[model samples]
Target: MYKLSIKKIIRLAAVTLITCSLFSCMSDKSEQSKSFSVQITDKPLTFCNPITLDFGTDRARRAGEAVVAIHQDDYYLFITGLRGYWYSGNMRDWTYVDAPDIPGGCPSVASDGERLIVSGDKSRRDVYASADPKSGVWEKVGYYDREYGDADMFIDDDGRYYMYWGWSQILPFQVVELDPDNGFKEKGKPVTLFFGDYKSHGFERRRPEDVIFSIFSYRDYLPEENPWIEGPWMVKHNGKYYLQYAAIGLELSTYSHGIYVADNPMGPFKYSPHNPLTFKTTGFMVGAGHGSTFHDKNGQLWTIVMIPSFYGGRGSGELALFPTAVDAEGVMHSNTEFGDYPQYYPGIKENAVANNFTGWMLLSNKKYVEVSSTLEGYGPEKAVDEYFLTHWCAATGDPGEYMKVDLGKICDIYAVQVNFDRHDAKLEMGRGFRMPPSLSQYQSYTVEVSGDNENWSMLIDKSNNTVDNRHDYTELAKPVKARYVKLTNVFTHDEGKFAVKDFRIFGNPDVAKFTKVKDIMVVRDPDDPCKAKLLWQPVDGADGYVVRYGIQPDKLYNDYLVYDDYTLDIHSLNRDQEYYFEVEAFDSGTDYFHEKTRQTMGIGAEIELFRDREMLARKMIVEGKNEYVFENIIPGTYQLRHTFGPNMWVGDLTKEQLIGSDNQVTLSEKISDLGVGTKVLGQLNIKVIPGKENGKFVVTLNYDKP
Candidate 1:
């Protein structure tokens, strides 16, 4: 039912022209003219991930659980908790449309080859139909009896409608056929599909520390130490059904999607050996889970997934798109390499998996930063740390507050993304934090560029802007040569202080990429196979390194980003899986050293470590340290228990609490009574000393186990 529009036709032609160079007609001795030879080039049509959108703000910025549905060759984007949806022709530019009558959160949209049907908001089962979604007109068509958490709606080639729903650590996904003629009622009994298999799949294991809320609060929904198998999406290809679901806690960096293939829509499915078809744990951006897949205007497969930002909080997220393909072996995979950087847009060239990256380097990471005024802990350097959770906040929202960055040298500045943050925001209740749905009442600012830091020219002047774009990204019409870039704040929201999370600038450094990283060593913890330590020699003139690893050498799907540090501790691995690792030193371009090794460590029931008590103030453990703030510097011995897990703290105690007891002190019996104290594994006799600043103390705890 879909027809090619003029816009799509022109876009396809443009992509073809950009990807293929038409040559002169071939000449032969036969005196006959042959058709022009079309040669394919590595030129990719690209777009950056964490796709830019006017995200809504509640307590913090929010947009996740995205579902993309195609109606008449147009794309409509639906997200969880967003009051409305977005419409796009090329999936790059989005126009938001508000529909008050429609429900929000965990939305599922499907087109029965003509009309688009939408259902969302776990509590609301009413199905809304929009013949023309771009018009924002809808009518109630059907309803279900109860809620469907993280539901997915799918229409088969045969025009049969199916509804899939489930979101629980203990429950399995269920699917049922829907009868459209009967108020979309179930046509048959619901069929249970699959449940979390943490024992068999390392990525599915749930870590208690990653829980966003109190573990007790989700007791009714999730079982302890079990992954939540949810977000079911079905894609039919080559007469086969591919059901994809997300596992691991959504709040964790390891959150990812796994696939199961079936011959029918309601499947008796088999898990794919390449379980996680889409995963990106490294780079500036993190997380690729709970997303939907759709074909673009040129029928190129692409997926839009939720990238957990955690800036707003636990469930806070943004959306990203990756190119996907089904290989000759019928295995489906997504291109997540250099995921956060610029990638070719869909239909730009063939084999998106190989020619995706645009090779634009990160030009403003850990660079020199200057700001007008700074809050106590929110220094200007936080703005370019490549971490979204931390931000540099000005003391006030007053005009003239600004932040500037020097990229070390004159570099080609092609794009800039200014990520604003919510610092000291005062909102009413949970909904008090408001980003105008009408795309108004946002920040007003101007971006200026300079080659010599003194003479500046306006690059992007949104001084009187009205749009509420917190994560604002702009691609320049042409690359500009500059070393100094500054953003002057004109006005900010009244409730929040002026804060910038990441002042990212991307372009080429006009230099050669760093050489392949060498002298790499990987050691797996004997006690905990899930943990591994990687140490490598730092490459000179390298921006950073990407440590890629996987179960096999050819499928190194997992990547972790490391900046400046020569050592990395990886806590996100399977307990009983062999992994191959390769380190790539990347600057403007990339280089790799493919290597594999098998290492192991031994687990112990109990272990002990001793540090000099005299040098406690200066000496600390290498694992991790805890900071405590008080009215004055506390000089005393502290008894802190270090657990076996990563960054796990058993308890905190002062000198008074440890006066009577010795090394086996009983600080809090509450944890012991719960029978969960056995995991403590060891303890640390930490002594607090005066920190670099008064009223601050640091207690470093090194684990005795691993």
Candidate 2:
């Protein structure tokens, strides 16, 4: 009986031990799963079917340049160049609002959450305000004559309203404070922003004597002149104001648009180092200028500009909308194509507060670091600079995540560094982040800093690595006084888990001086034999040189010539005739242009014709839709030729077999030639299948000419 009782006790003990072990295993799995988790609820919002409004016939008298704005969920459009008319919509359709009883021929419009402000010329410069959209009543509260031209209004985050407009006929820009309650009144004296002479501003390019003075042609004293600044518009975002305006000059072919930026709405605005933010339709005779910018309901920013189909003619332009993104310097840049919406990565949400603070996410290492105050335990203390891993159960390999950090409080950062480590113990063959799949492997990493977490700046970027484990660093001169920092890995292999150790922010400040030019040289009409070679002294520290010369100082000159070498050869000139020339130097780091040198030259003789006809034939075959064959009877190593455009051709057919002794060869049928006059070569045609959420199109080009 004692032996049997001992056996029963032993059996019970074993069973209890087994149950406890099972429970421990289950709990461990649960904790691991939670650590490597992701939530898709934070994805960026997608918008489609943009609401478009036609004010009138494309060239109708009443149809003119228009500006669009969004308040709350309502879309308001202010069309000018007409007497005055407004339009309203709600993301779907637009309803025309009759012009208020105001007398503005070319009016500009803006909104400040409570009222819509329109400023333009009635009898003189005037400002009108309306609270309700349905009501057509507009009351004039302010007026300025000589101090304003084509005015625009902007309300900043601090509840301060500002108005930016052109000053005198010579000076093109001025800014003033506006009191919403008392209308937009002059808070202070108008500040003259940009002023320059007509020739320096590219106004009278061909004939200085035939200079045309319109509202668009004004003297802007700003440093750069690709497009002459006019028609000022302002928008404030994340504590910065962006001024988008029309730059009318012969350099940009007249009536083009560009952007400038300033910390405050008042004086001292700087043109974007990357100016001419957006290029209009190339040869469609489209003139893009006089635009306004606003944010949509989803917080996406868009710019509506007048891209008139009639350029160099006598008609108004149509209004087209383009998406824009702000950089670390608060400068705005538009995307390459129109109608292309900005894409948001998954696992990132707009206006999300982590630890009660709002910010945007920057992705890196297939993991996301939630760097916001809204996150639990996120504070000045107890904040761990570590990686937040995410699971890839639903997708192949490992998925990535993004987190936003507020940088308003932190300023003067020297360097930002990130360290990464793999998760698995044994190294796997395919283990890394991929950038766009076509490439073979991940090669580099880059770090960017931003003040508002919206506009990002590249602090350090490095590529071409041979080692599996390596450390990279980048030194920044401008110790970023930013609110956000993003680190990205440009690796495209198989996605796997990686670990980031810590982010180190240091303080180092070192600034560099801008370069200036000394002298320049130009060779006029070298090919025509009638032109002369012009020369000038080189500026110290200049990265490159630009030479501007033409037959007449004002019109039909060749495009500005850019060269890394000190000298330039201009091929546009008439023999025995004097031609004007100007040379400028550009600093590569800052992209600042030095003072220009002017000179004159005369053409003396003509040169021999050395046309690459064989190269031209190959270019033509590449550009034609149907397969082309070259047939001839010559057999003594004659050159095969192809022409893509009038002065452009492909040469040296030795790289690939052209044809047999019969001099006949058929081009590939699959090759797509975009026909003659198409500037875009080797473009990929993508057809979006209805209802498909994601797809990619890739195009490649090969050169057979040697």
Candidate 3:
């Protein structure tokens, strides 16, 4: 007979086991109780799925080198590297093409209907020839000795070929024209375009002579004033000449592009009031010069240019293609990555724009007034006053105070109104005033628009007017269009401080919307108990879902392990262990909007015990309450030996001896202790530690009674 110990009973009753944290139990009585070995599953963390495209044979050959152009139908790829030139079919299949005999290293390639032109560095400055695209053969037609390198070529509708080559070795704005018949002929000597002595000309100091031909002051040659102008590319669209070039330096931080309108290819040009068309963003850097323009098969205008990639060592650059759009006024606008190509990937969140004023301050004295929108109470107030100013101020003069807003889509704006307070007491009649004073002191403010925050338009002197003493509201009108708006102080008195409550603009709305997620579930595989399936419901209007999970609950929301499908299979899961998961929805129209779901946790089934393995035990002595305990007996029928109280275990003797309210017993017929098939109680041990302090203790107890 078997008996139970009071201590063991009390410990078992006190322990409240959580299924997810407990061990599994296996038993042989039921087929469903069979145990299977389990192992932990490894999940990957990444949102860039299909991140790598396998071009069968076209593996990237070298670091900083990539196949930029792929023409599968033509069986050719225009490959460019840091130092070499090659052509490949199907990317994987390659044949090295002889490097163009050029002096410089960074080469750019373009083609006319008649021949291919490779421009950059050494050998032939303007090398050209009608070579077989397949055989990699070049029949050198002509080499312009003076147009030595770093040149771009374009063919107009009139079948005229034009080349814009930089010639800074002579003068600042040296542009030589190349005629298909005579090559590069000097039309005019290099012209000095920009004023270099001004303190505002710091960006032009380190400009590369090889890339920048000249820097022209926009204010000198055009109706609308602009500062720096460089990196020129001439394109004829709808019979209008558009000279698109870089406005600032070639570096990522200060780089930007602009377009000038001209009727003649080589004559005077007018800087579009909408200059500096392309600006920088968090994901994109270096929006500068040395770019080319092209039209696709659909006649849509696109700019193929080089943009820097942070993945490259610092200061390194990469080439990118951006779609360009022009407004009715002929001003070109390049949309931000989030605004134009939002659906490039899944699980990517848009960076929030802050409207703090601490950084936008322009002060002659350190005692400037604190004029911020948040301090004056405004809706949608995530903007905070940061200690540091905009980085643009490091190079150019103060960019005036400004706010960054997510306009949602690509649109045009014509006018803007600002609410501000004058804070500086020592104010010059013509010079801009310093800051820090009461809001009531601000009498008037000025507003401007710029594709780039570094360069801005002059104040709308006509639009400048006084507002009420209670709250100042000023409207600035100049009939200008822009994607971004900036406001500055034009006139002030008595060291007054001004807070910009908000800037109202007249333009089209471009807002992005997000999709929503509904539900998620997990279940065991119907055909295989060793496997499990994770499933989720699709979000309304969502293009797909980004699902992520991990062993630790905290790591699940780290924006990793993104899956676009509705279900995933769990090949191996640890038994009696918990797992956590998270899901997010992605919209097809905009890549920035994502809705995340709450985290969920689940546990696997428990383990069971079998009788076949337990029957082999050698010891059969009952070790509990002596009143109900029994000694070993032969395998057979026996008379009633004893009776036990509730929660007691009986052993040996006849089957009747094991009968009790809460008693369990096993009868073994074989002589050697308990036979192999006999049932026995298993032991479970647990250790508890003090939650707040360092302490340890142990307790041991037997399972069944003797």
* Top-TM-score candidate index: 1
Which runs in model 2 stand beyond 4 Å of their true positions? 1-59, 83-92, 145-147, 167-169, 180-183, 196-228, 249-254, 311-314, 336-706
Between 2 and 3, whose lDDT is larger? 2
Cα lDDT tens digits for candidate 1, 284-335: 6767789887766655567778777644333466778776666555666666
Which pairs clash inside model 1? Answer: 45-344, 45-345, 46-343, 46-344, 46-345, 81-105, 428-432, 526-601, 526-602
Question: Relative to the unseen true structure, what is the C-alpha lDDT of residue 537 in candidate 2, on a scale of 0 to 100?
Answer: 74
lDDT of 3 by residue, 603-635 (tens): 111122112223211211222211112233223
By lDDT, the best candidate is: 1
Q: How high is each candidate's TM-score?
A: 0.72, 0.39, 0.36
Where does candidate 1 stray beyond 4 Å?
1-47, 55-61, 208-223, 310-315, 428-440, 509-514, 523-531, 571-578, 589-706
TM-score of model 1 vs. true structure: 0.72
Question: How should the candidates be ordered by lDDT, best one leading?
Answer: 1, 2, 3
Model 3 weakest lDDT span, ten residues long: 9-18
Score residue 397 of candidate 3 by CA lDDT: 16
lDDT of each: 0.65, 0.39, 0.33
TM-score of 3: 0.36
